[model samples]
Target: MATSAPLLGKAAHSKASIFYGADEYLEELKKRYAHDHEIAALKNALPGEGDPNAAGVAQSNDKMLSVQKNNENRSLKTNRLFPTPNKPDPMPQNLAFLFTKITPEQMIYMWNVLTAIFCSQVLMVIGYCAALATFPDYWWTCTLCFGVPFSYIAIQNIYIDHDVMHGATFPVYEWQRFLTHPFADFFSLPWEEFVLEHNRHHASTVDLLIQGEFGWDPEEFHYALQQWAGPWSSNWYKYLLTVPFIPVIHFFGLNDTGSLFALEWWMHFPDEGAGGKCNKEFWSKWIPRRIKHNAFVLSLWACIWLLGTYPLGRPLSEGWRFMFTVSFFARIGYSAAWMFITNFTHSF
Candidate 1:
């Protein structure tokens, strides 16, 4: 019992030591926390302690105001051309005032279009030379050399055309107008017709029966099918068969017979009603313009071919044949791919 009493006394002493150490640690922590609080309070009281303006806070305030005024003046000068709206501007830092020069963001957006256009031009020139030199013997290689780049340019031009029509590009409408005609010539779609169709699509987005613009209503589909291939053969099988010829038809601008003939009707008798035909006024104006534009484009291509082949001692006939083959394949491939994507997506 005496030995057990000694061990119990040792255990009591150990517990007392632990409690005393903990109380001392807690007191140290409290002092450290109080010291940190005082330092923070001093910092908050003297925010500009290390600054030269600490003794002259009013001067500092005046300097800030002057700087703000200078910024305002600069902003006013920058925005002299493009006046902001009355509403509170959402993007104050945006470079909206730079009208003459393109910003980094605009350059990035247009990089692909510019690259595609340049590459297509170079490829066309190269293809013309190659076709003139080795067309008859290496027609397949010539077709690929010409057709792939041509197809790429056509598709890219279509994207640019659509973006221009939607006003999605740089806000300079004049620049867009300048590029519109050339792009139209290359894509084989008149700018006027494209605008009319695209605007109609935007206006009548909900109407699904309006032909070659937005949604293709089943009823209008049947009607167009019936009109093209007589009423008795307007079935699914006929539609499937017609699908294969769509790209060719589109390439030749013969997809809508009713629309084409309607132009002739208007030119001859402007006073007469369309009478179940496509819009006569639209087609009448468009047809003559398209004819002239298409002629210009054809002449341009012919000139390029002649320049390439005649000087190189190659036959003109071979040049014509090679160009025609390249044009056909490129147009068909582009139109078919575009149509498939549009049909699959089916959204405006």
Candidate 2:
């Protein structure tokens, strides 16, 4: 459906006047002659309704007519004009107020800050893992179980995933975006796809007919479940506490299909071509693209796992393991924080 444009200030004024019978009406005629020069002054003040001050003049005249008496007739005219203030047009919604307008230099500064944090996470993991390796016999029990995976989870999952998604974690070169954007398939959903879907969500927001399809509305899901499950259904607390489960649900490809509409677009990037190839190419292209991403992700993970398991000269297997584990956890933490921030602001 097409969106209705907002009304302008002049259009609103003219529309209001027509509804209240302000122009060329019986009451207006009496007001015209009630004080002979009154209408002339109004016409001078308001050249046409298109004039900027026309609404103001019309509104002020409406107010004055109420008190100015004409004793020759009834206490007031049969129809009375309702006065309203002249309000300006509303401004458009701003999606990128916080960061988009920032200078490229400032953006570069943010990029550097993010890079430092990412590098620091890697360093910390290596340091921790090396210390564990040195005391392997003594701390083997404690380090083997917890230390390794935690570090991997933090670095890969939190910092690296965040940087790529925001386009901040890597160098600004084309090769960097090309390399990192693919990583989305592994740790999180596809960033390019997510951004495209996000744009539509912003465009449509509370449009109830279209808003909830892409897992945007948990309330809708709970409501549906409650209807089927009946009064014995769990309360919202029991229902909503499962929010953190959404990402995992998405990861397992449960909500993987998301909105069919967005997927339709994905299959048809730029979405333009000849008829047969256009339709056939969507799935033909989509499957391989997904597979390629999966292959890349699996290969990357395999390398990480291999490095973690085998001794690489002086660097012990445990050290690599810790680095991988911290990276993963850090990503999860960052994803949770980012999601909460988005939902809190936009859901308002």
Candidate 3:
């Protein structure tokens, strides 16, 4: 009772010692006690054995406050980037239309054609070379040797490849199955891997933005063109003059400055992996099982070198010389024309 005045001045209306005239103070005190009770209950219900003591209560409260603050910050950041779902999202109409046109059936047809063309191109290359070997005195033998491979590529494209890519060349028609398989060299590709990578490329195609070099990767030509474009970009005539060598270097690998060294090394040991990692599962591992594998091929190359002395064993020298002049030059011309025709169809 003696200290009621001091306590009443601060709290105004404690239950044990109330201020009789202060109705507003009584209401305020009730609200404060209600809030305190709720906080105490929340702290008790929390998962951890929260401190019953003042210091522990303060630490627990601080942690809860910090968590609430972090959540509020994250909510603000997310809202800024992606608006709440009530608003209508916009997309390009043309792209939407394009997607609508694509169907599962179309995809299957496109796959069938690409598979056929790739196989046929391989056999066609070999067949074209074999044909060139038959005609010894054909003047265009020089031109034909080169021209045949590219022509075969074009024929395959027009007759078989295009229709397959368009998905119009399905085996639903008898001719489609007949033209695309044994004729095209059906077993050349690992269809699963090629299909996945090519489909990714197909999805990304835009005129010049991401379209690949015909079916071949354009990256192969990047550095080769860099020197011509740089320093020579301003001189129009000089660039034009260098265009002839461009195809020569690109297809035949002649101008492949550092890669020529790599090719020489590779020729010593044939590449059994079809441009993939060398592993036990790869064809390179089983190469030794063949009698005419790396060892026999290398021996043949050694024989060619040994036979090249002008005065010693003229028969071997003459035979090897004729063989290489025709076969070697023929292969070079074949590769060049094939690459050029491919580039022509796909380029803008």
Q: Write the per-residue lDDT of candidate 1 for residues 193-224, one digit (tens) a residue.
A: 44433332332222232332222121233235
TM-score of each prediction: 0.46, 0.43, 0.31
Residue range 1-348, candidate 3, lDDT tens digits: 212332223334445653322444334433432433323333332333321321222322221111121333321222222112232236477656533433334434444554556455445444443444455356365445555564455444443433343332122222233233222111111211122222222322212322331222223343234234446547666656655665555334331111332243233222233355353332532232222232333443444334333333345446455335433443344334434443443343
**How many backbone collisions does model 3 have?**
3
lDDT of 1 at 190: 44
10 residues in a row with least lDDT, candidate 1: 60-69
Candidate 3, pairs of clashing residues: 113-164, 119-184, 120-184
Whole-model lDDT per candidate = 0.40, 0.36, 0.35
Query: lDDT score, residue 81, model 2?
Result: 29
Model 3 stretches astray by more than 4 angstroms: 1-97, 122-146, 149-234, 237-245, 253-348
lDDT of 2 by residue, 1-348 (tens): 001212111122343452322122223333422332322232322212321211233322332111222444221322222222343335334633432322323333443444445445445445545555566665555444444554344334444434433332223332222243222224322333443333333222233332332223322332233233333345546535565554553333222222233244454343344553443444654455455555655665455445454433334445455445644444444444434433333332
Model 1 lDDT, residue 314, Cα: 64
Q: After superposition, how far is residue 290 of candidate 2 from its true place, in Å?
A: 6.1
Query: By summed lDDT, which 10 consecutive residues of candidate 2 come out lowest?
Result: 1-10
| Candidate 1 off by > 4 Å | 1-119, 131-136, 168-189, 207-223, 226-235, 254-295, 346-348
Better of 1 and 3 by TM-score: 1
